[model samples]
Target: FFWGFLAGFLEIVPYVGTTIGGILPVFYMLMVSDTLWQPLAVIGLYILVQQIEGNIISPNIMGPSIKINPMFIILGLFVGGIVWGISGMILALPILAVSKEIFRSFDATEPLSYLMENGLARKKDVFLERFDHEKHRILRLFFEKREEGE
Candidate 1:
């Protein structure tokens, strides 16, 4: 009952909650059980459940509603946790959603909004394209300088 309740409560947290919820029971099993197989079984079950939740369930359910890239969600969680601990993690998604909207509202920041979005249909390699353009410009200047010297 206690493990179930704990796991349910932690499920409110994004990304790492299910993991921490599973760890507690596994630790308890490790200490109390006489046989090693029991604890190992607990670990395997938790791993399977977590994999299902993370990959299949989450992407299907939360992916559309949240509309942020999985990469950005993970990054937000890390930054939020680092800056404000547990509270930060809890608030991260809403904050990101709001910020993405704010970015979308302005024409100048629309590109940032696109980067944060889950959509991949119109994905732009902004950084690489800019870097490649710069590289060609620099090489042209370098050759121009060499020709002038000759």
Candidate 2:
């Protein structure tokens, strides 16, 4: 139940959304608990749950649909924190996501095309020469299987 709620809440913001949402529970436990050890325990529990989510859960559940770069998210949080306080930090990445989608629409394509070409779409293309002939062997195996199937 707690995990479910955290997952849903984290879905709203891109990038560090999960981390941002994870902080709330830790702070709440620290603030409400009587003993120092209780807060420490809650923090440990949060880290454990986050590890599980990152390794097993997120890979299977949110594998392809929710893919966002971590750098952008960090920038969002920093800018948002600077601008509008904690709430801004929370909202910045989501707003960027929504705006990015909107800008990608056909109606806004011209301006967005230039922006994307200049900003996000720039990437280094590295060429590598392989010594092993494994790729050809793998292709031949696949072709043989397809031919056999037919």
Candidate 3:
């Protein structure tokens, strides 16, 4: 009951959603249970609840709210795990969600909008611009050499 209740509470979080919440109860049982059979039963219950949540509850409740691709989630978790360990991994989803929202808001269609879009687009533009400038410099050098020879 406690595990289920906590799972309900953790459902409030965005992407990580119920997964971390579901794991907690089983881990607690593993640590605290006196009898082998009881811990196994508790673990079994957690697995059952997880299946139900994954199939029925999560689809209905969280749905597109956390509809980011699994690859991105893995990337976030990997970076978060590297930086902040388990807590970082746990918090990564919300952080990524907020960042994505910010990026979307910045993607307006204007010069100012271009400036505002905090993303690789702006960076790529800058790089490309710089490359063009360098190419122009090289062309100028070639022309100067030709003129000198003439």
Predictions ranked by TM-score, top down? Answer: 1, 3, 2
As for lDDT, the candidate ahead, 2 or 3, is 3
lDDT of 1 by residue, 29-94 (tens): 989999999989988887887789779997899778879987899999999999999989989899
TM-scores for candidates 1 onward, in order? 0.55, 0.41, 0.45
Off by over 4 Å in 1: 13-20, 69-93, 107-112, 120-150
The 10 consecutive residues of candidate 2 with the worst lDDT sum are 124-133
Q: After superposition, how far is residue 11 of candidate 1 from its true place, in Å?
A: 3.5
What CA root-mean-square deviation does each model show from the true structure?
10.1, 15.8, 11.0
Candidate 2 residues lying further than 4 Å off, grouped into runs, are 1-46, 54-63, 106-150
Clashes of each: 0, 0, 0
Ten-residue region with minimum lDDT total, candidate 1: 130-139
Better of 1 and 3 by lDDT: 1
lDDT of candidate 3? 0.65
Per-residue lDDT for 1-150 in model 2, tens only? 784498568867755776777677777777888878876876787778778877999777853443445566677779999999888987875776676566556432323322322223343231112212344233454455454556
Alpha carbon lDDT of each predicted model: 0.79, 0.61, 0.65
